[model samples]
Target: MTVTDTAPRALRTPRADRSNGQWKVDGRAALNGTEEFKAEDNGINVRERIETIYARDGFDSIPDSDLHGRFRWWGLYTQRKPGIDGGRTAQLEPHELEDRYFMMRIRSDGAALTPEALRVLGSISTDFARGTADITDRQNIQYHWIEIENVPEIWRRLESVGLETTTACGDTTRGFLGSPVAGVAADEIIDPTPVICEIKRRWLGNPELTNLPRKFKTAVTGHPSLDVVHEINDIALVGVVHPALGPGYDLWVGGSLSTTPRLSERIGVFVTQEQAPDVWHGVVRIFRDYGYRRLRNKARLKFLLADWGTERFREVLESEYLGYRLPDGPPPAPAVGPGDHVGVHPQKDGRYYVGAAPLVGRVGGATLAGLADLIEQVGADAARLTAFQKVVVLGVPEEGLEAFVDGLESLGLTARPSLFRRSTMACTGIEFCKLAIVDTKDSAVSVIADLERRLADLEPLLDRPIELNLNGCPNSCARIQTADIGLKGQIITVGSGSGTGSGGVQVPGFQVHLGGGLAGTGRDAGELGRTVRGLKVPATEVADYVERVVRRYAAERTPGQSFAQWVARADEEALQ
Candidate 1:
């Protein structure tokens, strides 16, 4: 009923005892000693105890072949129900596995056609009989609802495409994320594509670093804008132009979002173009060594940074980087162009790149195939997908821009930038994810449609964008905290009074929160507003209330003012 702020418990370290030859003790008994004989015996006993526990819990590893049948092998799995079988809905299970999904990333080098890769994808689709492939936000392709029986065959097929599923999941480093418009953007400070490739080459499938305390994420931005939500990544290298170092980046470390969301702390070290890889490795090593593993919830790099303050974290990183001398790099210079890659823009080569809007980040199978065809026709100098759920078709010659734009229009995809659509995002919700409590995608679409209909009278209100984010659960995958209008699903009590023997109570529809924002230049988006009980007002009515608030307080704001600023300036009680 209420969003409670539960403080985390403090970490406790075991105390050491010096009474008996530098022995370790818990309470008052001898725990371990420096004696060689006792230490060997202790190690044997510990290993035996661990093996016993693993056996009792059935936590041993399962072969890749039996991944599907052994549903509980990984502690959790996914599958489909009979008759509910095709489409994305079949993938959604509240708390059970029907099938398993595996993902792989491949680099195509902007070539016209990779028949081998296409063959592999098609073969996997056939082998699984039910698996569907979708491209991810990070320019990687994911094959979902894969049957366990086809794991080996799928791997073989992927191998033909220069792809592998070995390090895609678990605690290993994921696919490196770079600006999709890497070399194609007109105003790029540096092309991060090669950088990402180098990082992946150095880290992927490395057994020595495969087992980590938690999964790690990293992003390199060629654009000044944090288009990849770089600040939320475990490691972020953002390109900035410094007068002294020419073009370089500032390294951000230990940032993540989950139940405990924290902004990354800057290390104050500017990485030169040549030293980025070395700096990245040093940060990962620090996290691997110092990250807490015993406490699963507190195992993230952010928690480690919290334990050791930013200064201390940097000191350890510096110690790690002692041998790898970096070139002299200076602070970033001011950005020259707009940060967003959403509209059509000219490339450095005098070509145009069209940013196509993919509503809700969903494109039909036919549409996806069509996009691939278009890319083939346009030449894949680069194709980028922004964090805002839009795709960019880069490096089309200026002469062909008109034709390419027409082709996009023919496909029902447009380059027109709408403030509402630009600022909206929703997770897959009930459509695919099991943890979703509400149909967030549908709800978001409906709310946006209604807002458009009601706000038709208020034209020229598109100067400033107002983010409206909806998440089905508190996981915040949609980044609800950075929105002007943030709506998180919550069950409210529909009826009051004692429950009758025959009568039943109604389930509450949704709980809405407003004005949560990320910290930076536009940091203050205020806190949660009032809990709008669904029983008294329908969900549709809630939309109307939001419209009224937007129209009242944000109708005639100053040039640079946002809806969030309006909310902050208004009297809290009146708004509530």
Candidate 2:
């Protein structure tokens, strides 16, 4: 007995009239609003069914209604190459798609992991995922090449270690993100571990929240550095202090980035550390009830927030949900940097936390297993996944620092990497993602390698960090909008219609964004990158263009000028 077996599938909102016996939910979105569609009609309560029925029956056993939609509720996405042989992905119909191997996203809320959990993740990746594993910016590990038959066993292994794929995708409370150094950071205002655990405990499998108009993302962090990316989540409980209330959270609502990017706005309400979970529950309830259910793209809480604004939204949360008025609270500290959290930094305790920079978040199962072993060997209790796709090993004693560093180096993870390597980020691109139009990971790696070789002599000039982010599509999966060097995918014809050597060639390319950064006085802050008009880089020439830009910055920067500052004062021509 599940939603599929009992809920009123024919029910429609009172405001809407039925058409052709289907609930035609109306839209408020101007872009893609007119067309009516039913999100729930896609499927109902398929998570457990996937394990109990679909996995046992094989891929063909899944009805079309489930394959394209219900499958995602359990964190399964068909990792198909939608656009074969260089055609536009969007132009193709569903029937034209190729391949059925799935991608499984394992939610790791708060970047929290135990060595035992790591071992489970690693073994699963190796045995079932074709050695494929990636640590996402959301503090999750995604595996490509997952098969239908193996999902049940994967769930068993994962659940044995206290991990789950539930609500990791598909319009539910997708997942929660917390500070990687939540309990361990020296300057943390509060530890978010308890809150993260509380959210999952209360809401993870609650059917009331399982169906939503679209995805909902939430982050809770008390770290002073704002390490959990409060501004980009639908609902973020950022650590703040109310003068009378002492330590609590400031609620932020509706922040998200995709084709339409909006920073989450602070709701001016202070929620007690204990009340944070309730506030979260209430806000999600609000999203579920009143959020746009028409257009899938407009279904995010951001759209609802946009139309309602925080004033009314807050009123509803107070009057209907929390049953108490939240008091005004101070804003969280402005981000000091891009919040990379890389390298060795001291914790409140005497021990040090070393953030190891992986190669743009790509690590094999063997590598992850080795990391787990190193954590045990080095006397560290846990490892954290940072927002920028890096690992921060916690509780390493001062005496064990040397051992930890050596072990990380042996694992191809380094305590200190090149500035580019540490800050570089890329999305899972055309290699696995269906929406992607270009290759991101391989191109990013090549660019980083080329830059490292060419800029060997320029290291002295890079007194501060620079971020290079690559996204396979305009969806901003790599946080491309805020990158110092943002590369968004597209197809471009690079010359006259009759030519040689990349001329008149329609190939994968990236739109160039320069000087984008989180802002600060000399070397810190947050700001979106400026787009260079008429500038796009072919995939093959990404390295060359990036090298030229960095070289120019090195040669021309004024005294004490950071990359962001240099780009601020630099002419657009000079940047290009």
Candidate 3:
């Protein structure tokens, strides 16, 4: 079939069975797998609808599908704020919700940024969004408290800086991630920026990809840290060297984490830097035509990759999409350190790039704007955001290194941070995210501060870096399942005065998981976190409990035993 023929409509007409709430094929519910929505022509109509209808008519104008599904294409979502309960909220109409504001997201194809772009971002947040700005795990800027009236202005500002919200949140080829230190890293195998630009140039808002079974995610990284979380995207181009081709990308398909967590599998093909975009196009087209569209939960590219396996997926791509075979490639280099670009690193260009960490990826408009000034003042050519929620200022001259570090420090952005401060990650919790269960940003800040204070004496023995991810829910948007210490927000009953849940009540707490890590970082990476039975910690006491566990690990660990290895053999009682 031609590329145009790969559209979802050209495929079989879906036969829906919605007896189980949503559309279902065999008693299993689907996302928007109903024949009705699929038969509605195009999901992209929301763009015109928003401009002509919704914006003109306010919140009440949103149709159910556009409110929940189509609005995402423009990076808009009605965030259910505080006082909005779990039940009934999901079923309620967007206008019926207490808060009518939207959470606006701006897509960055390569996680790349510039001073002009950031100023626009900061302006949008401070001017229109009430100073609420967050850098998401996917390396995009997210704003809350946005209204329909403000969207036009926001889009205008964004467009002025060469940024767009199109396909940022929809069931299309959402934002693709690239290395935070893409062109500047000293140890990078290859720079993937050009490939990312090519992909965006060809398919940013192309209508052919606007309608898919479900949302799609992609990442391309050449850094040794595996900077983009390669194992967790639908299609990832990881840096690898071919025996004859030198530096190129190794292809991986079908990685995702939600209720079902699966690390991507390498497809064993070497794609030259020039050929990367075509390969990407081929894979996504294959997904469009052959992917499972019958079940929402099962419609991710991972499901197709899982069922087809890497070999078959590659075979179809070669035969149906690219019409040519690709050369076999080698595996990515093992990770040397954490992917977050915090701290100072010398670039290959004899300059320095500073990766400064903001508290748990939470930064406001003025701060981001201030950072834009710093980037410009320091004579840095550009700045980029890391998947780790850190920002990297690139092209700093050697003379400006000291000034740059001090400037970041002045903004409360840290170049050198404590292990706990550097390692902690938190998702957008109950504050804005509708799916979140508890408060995350401040709680994470509090927990990290507490951990830093109480564990001060243990700082010397903290040789092994720990990954502590606090996700407000089990959605894994923060990749909680792949962290060393994963905290899934929940309301757990503490029978008596227990750790954080010590109020003799079932309050906000976390279901703790241990031993998870992304692959290629340490010698032993890429393992999912372990779940212990009845392992729940009150949010208030999380720091204390984590301290106790770390102390025990330090004292009891065998020589060279990583946290995951120790957790594998340690007595079950010691975990608590």
Candidate 4:
């Protein structure tokens, strides 16, 4: 199937004509500032400028338009400076908070990596980014401390390894998330590797899709584990079998999180493997043509779906984009395994794949390089990064399994991680993200260590892992709203202190959200966590609070009651 280069219909609709191409309403005749700037120049055009002008001339050569707006198109962002506390996050301007260095995101489409590719990533991190790298939830590798002058060489190295930063950020199709064990899993319904590869080849660098109303995320998964967190992406295709058509994908759309969180709604469409790429193209094009654009906050596809609803959306997609109707089909079967994929698992090929957990996604360049050596020594050829911020090394034979596990442990990766370590997730917080209001990676690490020690006795009482997601802001970059214990970071007033009539000291803290979860936990659909009134957890006391609430759940839960179920039924007093 061919994705056309035609401009989206919204660009030439009656609304566009009325506003003389500005696409405004109520005779306002004014586009949002960001939209107006994008119209002046395509964000991709900055790539040439970055290579030719900024790389040689240095960071000061970048104008504000390109620095703040266009740079994100290529996955570059100015990281936050050290020593800046959460209290000052809102008081200072961006330039004051930002460091000269950049954070570069490497889009690992399908999260697959060869030994050679892994080495290159390791070397780049060590040589260019001060040995710092993070495995993001969307299955991309993020590096910090990048300089403008080093970007060209970094891009060259990534391209050599068949990886890229293109559309890894900004208002474009971000990295496509697939099941980490896409092709090798023993019980996968249908491998999505081919569909993922085809979609990337056809539309990855296409200029037509480089700009959208806002970021568009996509996920495809064949694993019953539901490993891609499909319920919260803009468009997701979960593997399922049609009653008569055999195995295919079920379409879900409009899932997102932030200050306003929304679970994706299935539009009752089934897609065959052959039609997957075309179906994805059609859905993205529909989003481009008809999505909200006037308000930046309202530009995500979720808002559009909320307004149009699923039935009208399906009709428009078929008529305007696909030119054909998709058959109504069944939703996926309930997730049967832990989505994180931690520990050893058998592969369909009679070999084994080992899933290892890194501490809250933190792995240094040296550790990664060492992991590559272990993979080669163990005769493994493939590795994948998971949505839960873990790594799976594939193709290990029975003979090398013991040695491989030892090697992973040496590199500080654990195939057998504790429940707390396996379930906790954190975003880049005040340490690197300019928008973050609190520290996340370090805070999460501390909490994990504490929980492991404190919750050891209660392990037998738990049947499922309780997801603890920590975000540095209300933006929900860590998928906080869909975690069992979602923490949105903010500064809260606490304790009577000098210089205050109301008497309080400002401290880094979180607003707690309980019972949020996705379909992987066996709920019929994704559910957002509910917030309790007047509950604020200080950053320092996260471990203490989590321990208290968990112990309470363990004591009070009935037989076969999941943590989410307990939260749903418990009184407000029990939650605290």
**Per-candidate local distance difference test:** 0.55, 0.78, 0.80, 0.87
Q: Report the candidate with higher TM-score, 3 versus 4.
A: 4
- Cand. 1 Cα-lDDT: 0.55
When sorted by lDDT, best at the front, the candidate numbers are 4, 3, 2, 1
Per-model root-mean-square deviation over C-alphas: 8.2, 7.4, 6.7, 6.0
How big is the positional error of residue 178 in model 1, measured in Å on the Cα after superposition?
1.4
- Residues 153-185, candidate 4, lDDT per residue (tens digit)? 999999998999998898899999998888888
User: Which has the higher TM-score value, candidate number 1 or candidate number 3?
Assistant: 3
- Enumerate residue pairs that collide in model 4: none
The prediction achieving the highest lDDT against the true structure is: 4
The window of 10 residues in a row where model 2 has the poorest summed lDDT is 1-10
Q: What would the per-residue lDDT of candidate 2 be over residues 404-502, giving only the tens digit for each residue?
A: 998998888888899778878999988888788898898888888888888878876687767789998889999777777888888877777633453
lDDT of 3 by residue, 298-329 (tens): 67777667666788888988987898999988
lDDT of 4: 0.87
Per model, state how many residue pairs clash. 9, 11, 7, 0
